[model samples]
Target: MKILHTSDWHLGRIFNQQSLLDDQAYILQEIIQQAVNHQVSAVIVAGDIYDRALPPADAVALLDRTLNTLIGEHNIPVIMISGNHDGAQRLGFGSSLLKHSGLHLFTSFDQLLEPVILSEAEGSDLVIWGIPYCDPEHVNQYYKVKTTDHQSAQEHVTQLLHEHIARHYPHSATHVVISHSFIAGASVSDSERSLSIGGAECVSADLFKDFHYTALGHLHQAQHRSYSHVRYSGSPLKYSFSEVNHNKGVSIVSFHADQSCNIEHVPLEPKRNVRIIEGELADLLAQGKKDPNNHDYVQVKLTNKEALLDPMASLREVYPNILDLVKVRNNEGSTNSERSRAQLARSEMDIINDFYHAMNNEHLTDEQRQILQNVLTELNNTDTERSSKRA
Candidate 1:
């Protein structure tokens, strides 16, 4: 059986303070079209259905419509899980009823071992285990395991699932596992929110060695982790300027009776492409004027020697979707260049003051300076307290 693997919809996501709901809606429609064209058995949405825990009304509506189109109209089965960004309780609401409609929303730890058995006419019985985003605290409470970090929690969960599968499922079944996590050795992008601080969130790729195919999420870049079978399908859209080079797409996995799988990436075309253009103001304007994709989202870098007034405003007159602007200094003799060099010798407070002035075009007032000083003092105290505790 063939299945479409996609995740991190982030339906209510905002890019440069601009709403991306319309673009999101368009990409989702493309995904549905891909599913129809491929004639896949089911769709697996790994996690991060919404941009935040409390999504906007329109985001909810778009998700509802997408689900209705897949499960109601197309009669396709969808297996989805909640990521760290999703409110598990909220996403899991009506999950029991929704499962009857071929929409399996797995969020709770109670459903970890349960398998969504997909029977195929030409392939072996496909057994899928959906593992949602498991916090360290949740794992400790539910599994009675002392997992202090994400790695331990994931290891414990996967071990339990493996043992359960060994005892219950037949050897001939094609096993597939769906999870949202940061596996060790996977490439990460700026768009993905850190699952945990201080690098304790990474789980070993060895945990998924037993499964025939592991569909992962959380990391925005689609990549394999230490093995071909363990992979991340990546987000369907580029959520950050850092991901401007990413070829956003979905993974189509086809499984055979021999427990072998083949995966293909189907590129998704966005309504507006994300691009970066660099040149002087005049050159950039000329290029923008000739470019057919002026409607595309852009980040411009100005390399002009002379200071331009309202450069962003001027650029927007031609490329209306310019999201970011930066002034690049070509020569090292500029005043801004000297300021950058002098900042290395300046004190932290002085540097902060300079930064404040640069950003707001005004010096920090006495009151604001005092507030910053107090904040720094509190942070230092907290650090000392942590150090004492560690000692």
Candidate 2:
């Protein structure tokens, strides 16, 4: 059976306070097209369907339309769950109606026991065990946990799921587990929402040793965990500057009865690109002109002699998504000038003078100190003259 694994859609997400709905819509369209081209039996969205507990009206409309295209137009079954950023009750609405359309939405801990089972005439049955964003307290209440640690939470949930799976089907049936949590050895980007207060909430990949395949989510970078069978599909779009170079896409997995799987990455085409360019503004503009790539969302590291005035305004000339402009203040003639700028930024006038004096102190520069004194005296004279004129 063919199953395409994808997650962390983070619909309604914003980058640097700019709405990413357009990019997100484009990514989802790409996913649908890939599903059609591959003729996958099921499209599994591991979790994090939305960026917030209650998505906006536009986000809701977008999700609704996308699901229609997937289920109505493409005729593909979709199995999805809620993540830390989603509210279970909110996404769970109309889930009953959606199931009839071959879209299974597991949005709460109460439904973890119910695995969505699908089968084909060729005698292959695939069971998808959907575990939404598991909370220690909620899981304890649902499964009656004896402990609250990360391992205990996983053990409690997995044990219940195992018991159910074992009772329903034998080890012969193809099984896939879906979850939204951090796993050990998976790289996390800054844009992903944390599940707990500390990193201890993440479970080790060994917990899923029994499953044939695990489609995971929550991390924004596509990566394999401690187990090759366990993997994260990552987000569809670059949600942060840290993920400027990430190949945002989806994963397609083909399952066989022998418990072997083949995974492939399907590239996504986003509306805008996120890029980081490091050099002077002139050099960056020159490079952009020379290159064939589009400079949509860009972060420039300016290795310039001086800080540009209104760097954002200057970068907007070439790239619209100029989120950051890092100035590398340097020049052979302006070493002291750069230090002065740093000191002034910190409002440290005495420290600035002390540093200047110390730098020249060892050189026996009496002439330099006199020059500095004369400059300071002129500054004081100007202040006194301005104050008297104002009085």
Candidate 3:
């Protein structure tokens, strides 16, 4: 039995203030083409179906058309779950009816019990247990179990699933577990939103090793954890520069009677690939002249230290699709991680001072510093009026 696995669609995503809907639509169509090419039994999306809870109207329309083409036109069955980025109830609306059309959306908690059984006349049936993204507190209250963090919550679910299988379908079918989680040791990218605060988000990968195949999501870079059977299909499009080398694709897993599966990674070619290029402004401009794919989503890290006049305009002349123009730290030759760590160790005013120096090659005057400090203090005041917007 074989199935197509993909995840972290993150539809309607915006990167560096640029909307990626067009790129997303193109990649999704490629995934559908792959599904049809392989003639897979089912398509499994691990989660993060939408970029946000209340997605824009266009994103919703894209999803509708994509699903219609996949299920209505091509007659492919799809299995999906909700991620932390989704509004579970909203995503699962009309899901009961959609499942009849072969779209099984597992968003709510109680769905853990009702496995989607892909019955075969040959008896090599597939039993899928979909675990949607849930908060530890909600799992505790719903399951009547005390799970204080993500690890505990997942362990509880794993134990319950084991008991359920033992009581009902022990060794009867090939079990596949699909979950949206930040599993331990999985590589992460800036594109992923934090599932929980204080780094309490990761769960042990050991929990799903016994399953025939476990499909995972949340972390953008697709990879297997602990065992080959447990895998993440990754995102079809690169969502951030942190994932510049992700080799975006979907995995087609062929399951055998021995519970071993062969995975074929069918790469998704995007209309515009995300890329990062670093060099001095003049050198980059010279290189961009010879570069063929200048329309790709590009992030340029300038090695030049001094402030320049109209650098973006100069770069844009060569690379019109440039997204970010980063001013690298003065001659230290730092990696992104090093710069991030250094920023975290700095105070807000110090960070702003660095930016000021980069812009004007001067520090703030005493009076200017005092005024900025007052503004910062006022912003930090708990009594200060604040406006809220959905991120």
Candidate 4:
């Protein structure tokens, strides 16, 4: 059985405050075309169907159109799950009714035990266990398990699913696990939100050892965790400037009759690619003037020592979609270096005065200085009062 694996659609995502709905619609059409070309039995959308819990009406409509084209028009079976950004209850609405039409939406924890079976006439059956994004608190409450962090929570939940699979299915069937999570050692980009603080969110790759193929989400970069079978399909669009180099695409997995599987990456071409251009202002403008990719979203870094008047406005004439601009100054004997030298020869008050001058482009007036002094004196007096109380 052949299956198309993709995730992190982030349907209503915005890049640099620009709406990506048109870009999203374009790429989703490409995905549908890929499905048609591959003649795959099913499409597996791991998670993150929307950019936010409360998506806009247009985003909702786009999703509706995509699903209709896939399931209604093409008659392809689609299995999807809700990611962290998705509101589970909202996305899972009409799921029970939709399943009759071959669109499987798994959001609840109770749905993990039941597998979506995809089979071909000649190949082995593919049993997919879809697990949605579950935080530690939810997992603990649902399963009555002691899971203090993301790793522990994932481990506990997966263990239960594994036991359930073992009890129900035979050993010969091909088992696939579709989950939304941050597996350890997977590459990350700037756009992805931290699942937890201090790295407590990363789950060990060994947890997926038993599955034939593990399709994961959460991370926006397409990569393998510990093994070839465990993989992240990544987001369809470039969500950040950091992902400018990523060859965004989808993964196609073909399961053979003998339980062996083959994985292939089908690259996706976006309407306008995200790119970064760095050079001096004059050179960059010259390059942009002749560049064929003027329509692409660009981030410019000017290496000019001297400030130029309205460089962004000038660049916009050539590259209309310039999203960000920055001036890179010389490090040696620069303003920072001069500030350091001045700080060494000055008192704390002098340093503070200079800082205020630099920030506001003006020095502190007599009235402002008096007000600051009065505030400082009050703070000192309050500290002294606390000390006296302690004594």
What would the per-residue lDDT of candidate 3 be over residues 204-285, giving only the tens digit for each residue?
A: 8899988889999888887988888889999999988899898899999988776678988888889998899998887899
Least well predicted 10-residue stretch by lDDT in candidate 3: 382-391
Q: What overall lDDT goes with each candidate model?
A: 0.89, 0.81, 0.88, 0.88
Tens-place lDDT digits, model 1, residues 1-391: 8999999999999999989999999999999999999999899999999999999999999999999999899988999999999999999999888899999988998888777999966657999899989989989998887989998899899889999988998899999999999998788887889988998999999999889999898989888978898999999999988888888999999998789999999999999999888998878888888889998899898886543557887789889999999887766566876866764666667768866754565678999999999988899999999999999
lDDT of 4 by residue, 212-286 (tens): 999998888889978899999998889999999898999999888888899999999999899999998778889
The residue-level lDDT of candidate 2 at 136 comes to 80
Superior candidate under TM-score, 1 versus 2: 1
Per-residue lDDT over 1-391 for candidate 2, one digit per residue giving the tens place of the 0 to 100 score:
7888999888898777788898888888999999999999999998889999989888899998998999999899999988888888989988878788899988877677778887877756888889888878777777665566666787788888888887878776888999888886678778977677767677888889789889998998888877777988888888888998788889999877676788988778787888878886667776766665545777788885432446567567667567777776555466787877774776234444445543443332577667766777899999999999999
Question: What TM-score should be assigned to candidate 3?
Answer: 0.83
lDDT (C-alpha) at residue 279 in model 2: 81
**Model 3 residue 256 CA deviation in Å:** 1.3
How well does model 1 score by local distance difference test? 0.89
Which candidate model has the greater lDDT, 2 or 3? 3
State TM-scores per candidate.
0.85, 0.84, 0.83, 0.85
Off by over 4 Å in 4: 332-391
Using lDDT as the yardstick, the better of models 1 and 4 is 1
